[model samples]
Target chain A: MNKTVLQIIRFVVLVLFQVLVINHIRLGGYVHPYIYMLFIMLLPFNTPKWQLLVLGFALGLTVDLFTGTPGLHAGATTLMAFCRPSIIQLISGNQKFENIPEPNLGQLDGMWFFRYVLCLVFVHHFALFFLESFSFRLIGQVLLRILLSVPVSVFLIMMILYIFKRERKRE
Target chain B: MYNLQRFILKHHFVILFILLEVISILLLARSQNFHRNSLVNTSNVVVGKIYEWSSDVGNYFRLNTANEQLAEENAMLRQQLSIVYDTASCVYDVNEGDTLYEYIPAKVVNNSTNQANNYIIINKGARDGIERDMSVISTDGIVGVVTDVSRHYASIMSLLHSKSVVGVRFKNNQEIASVKWQTNNYRYGIVEDIPTHIVLQQGDTILTSSHSKIFPEDLMVGTVEEFYPTAVDALNKAKIRYATDFSTLRHVYVIKDLHKAETDSLKAKFQ
Candidate 1:
């Protein structure tokens, strides 16, 4: 499939899944995993800086509209996108991206991919929860929420990516 | 001029990032103000319609629970009706003459309890006589207040939200306090401003106080789960278990105070 068309389909599917399914899963009221961050994470390596930021903002705004939070998700996701390129460079030190088309489990070493996902997911979740609380007064609760939610979100995103990669290999 | 253009072209990414962040911050600021009509809430027709469709499917899975709640409310209403009929005819006539509150039934199209700032979208909206600032309550207890309304839908600030507060009083002694959700727990809220003289007890019922302009007096709020004296303030604080199970909330009533305008105008004179 064409890469652009594939990414578009992934965008719609992930957004629908996040809003309709994941948003309803409130385990202990603390583990609200935002799996839609996968859409931003999985974008092509060569995607333009401008496109990355715009797409990130649009994706988050779509969720905010559905969830009735006007700008909380938008701000966090945009910040994640802004930091993506730098985080990628910082994680893949001394490694060249000449042969790699994008960051994925198949193309990157398992440890490297895990570290990358963890870093970006942490940034997203940290920004999201802190922005949602928007207060230093509730810093303890906010930190606890970030600590609990990030791992769940990272795990779910990686699981979905692994399943899709396997299906593509079989095809 | 060429040097300036080159600088702009070289650092466009940073400029764009800052621009988008600024827009997001503006939106965040706008939404934080309680009275402002935000541009990107679920009360918008498109978003509300989507949630309405999804909740339609979700409703089937919880039908049994919803039915039980309705049945329980019916029994309670019937009990109230019998008492009303048993009263003196003169007193009944006087009660009929003054109807201070009106209720508009609405279905929950979308709801969330886990977010720090949670909101509920309902099916009824401006067309159904739902307006901003009207109080919402479930069959069991108070829910929230309407904050935004479109033609076909309205968005409510749920009691689970960090900023949501309700004026409440103890049912046993009528001593007033305010309930606020300071923690992530949906079933519990923190009660503040309790008078130092009032004795505390677990399982005490809390009801909406007459001091509130939005909610009616004596509506069920919750029950005392625990109490403690805060180190900083002389007032005692307590934890209360909300009467309404927000996780399964489906149907609700939007209360319209008939004399709200009169009350506001009268209160404005003092200000």
Candidate 2:
């Protein structure tokens, strides 16, 4: 499959999995896994900066529409997309992450990929949670939600990254 | 001019990003673009379909829990129905001339207690003799006021939700206040802006005042859970434990007075 078709398929499967499956897996309280971020993280490195932003916004807005949080998810995901290039460079300046098939644990390995994803995921989720809670004051409750959500989101991200790692090993 | 055009074309990706960001920022800042309602956007259709499918899937999983709850409620309702004729409506015990208090039943088809600006949807609508501004209550206490009515469904401003401001009095005392939720904590909220002259205690019971045309004279809200008298301002704040367990609430009554529309119209004219 070509890049666009593969990307589209990946997006559909991941988002469907998130809304249909992952969102339902709410662990007790506020710790809901956000496997949806895979859409943004999976965008090919060589994708144009503007295209990346738009795609990110589209993916986020989609999530927001489903979740009933208008503009919040879009805003958070767009921020991640905007900073994707910087994150790649920060992770490895010489390696040129663009030529790679997609983001994977094996490709950006030895905790480089983990930390890279960790930072971006936190940024995305922090923006989302904060924006939704904007009208209300940030009590300990708000902090608690963020702390709870991070681990779930990280686990999902790692799982998706592992899939990419598997695909890369085949090549 | 050619060199400038080439430069612009070379940096077009950056320009596009800037433009897109500006659009998103604009939507965020101005809430009502009317035509730009996110619910009607391209993303919405896809997301809506996915969410509907997800809700269907999720509801299946939650059905077991929901079944247990329904069974418990059925027993409670059956018990209440059995004793409907025998029990006294008023707790304080009325004197000589007291009219029979009537309750208008309503079923909540739609409920949103988790959201900030939440509303409850009742199956009763215009056809069911429902109208806007009617007070909704459960046997436990006040639920909300009917805000909108259609042919089949009426929407209510849920008491647990934010933006619910009902006029209330404290323990048959001098001060009248508005009861509103601080957040999603439906069990508790503050009776804000109560006057200083009203002496308060920890155990003092707060009730819905009759001043608001919605509810009648005195209905139980909850006991004063906590209080902080104003250090600077005259009005004090006190947290109230709401009577109804909102999470477990099932049935409710829509309080409709015959004179509600007239009174509502008169109030609107003055405003």
Q: Which prediction has the highest DockQ against the true structure?
A: 1
Q: Write the per-residue lDDT of candidate 2 for residues A1-171, one digit (tens) a residue.
A: 577787788888887777556654535444645778777776767777888888988887766555444576788888888888888888776776555666666665648767777778887877666665654575566667678888878877887677667765765
- TM-score for all models, in order of appearance: 0.95, 0.69
lDDT of 1 by residue, B1-271 (tens): 9999999899999999899988888888788887544575433888888888899998999999888988999999999987877885656574565889898999999898888888898999899999999999999899999988888989899998877889988998988889999657889999878877887789999999999868999999999899887667879889899999998899999999999999999999999
> lDDT tens string, model 1, A1-171?
887898889888998899888988879977889989888888879999989999999999988888877778999999999999999999988899887777777777778878888999999999898888777887887888899998898899888988888665543
Q: DockQ, per-model, please?
A: 0.76, 0.36
lDDT for each residue of candidate 2 in B209-269, tens digit (9 for 90 to 100): 8786667668777778888888798888888888866664556788767555566799899
Docking class of 2: acceptable
Interface RMSD of 1: 1.3
- Residue runs of model 2 more than 4 Å from their true location after superposition: A1-35, A133-152, A159-171, B1-8, B30-166, B171-174, B184-187, B199-223, B230-233, B242-260
Model 2, residue B86: C-alpha shift (Å):
7.8
| Candidate 1 residue pairs in backbone clash | none
- TM-score of the second chain for every model: 0.94, 0.62
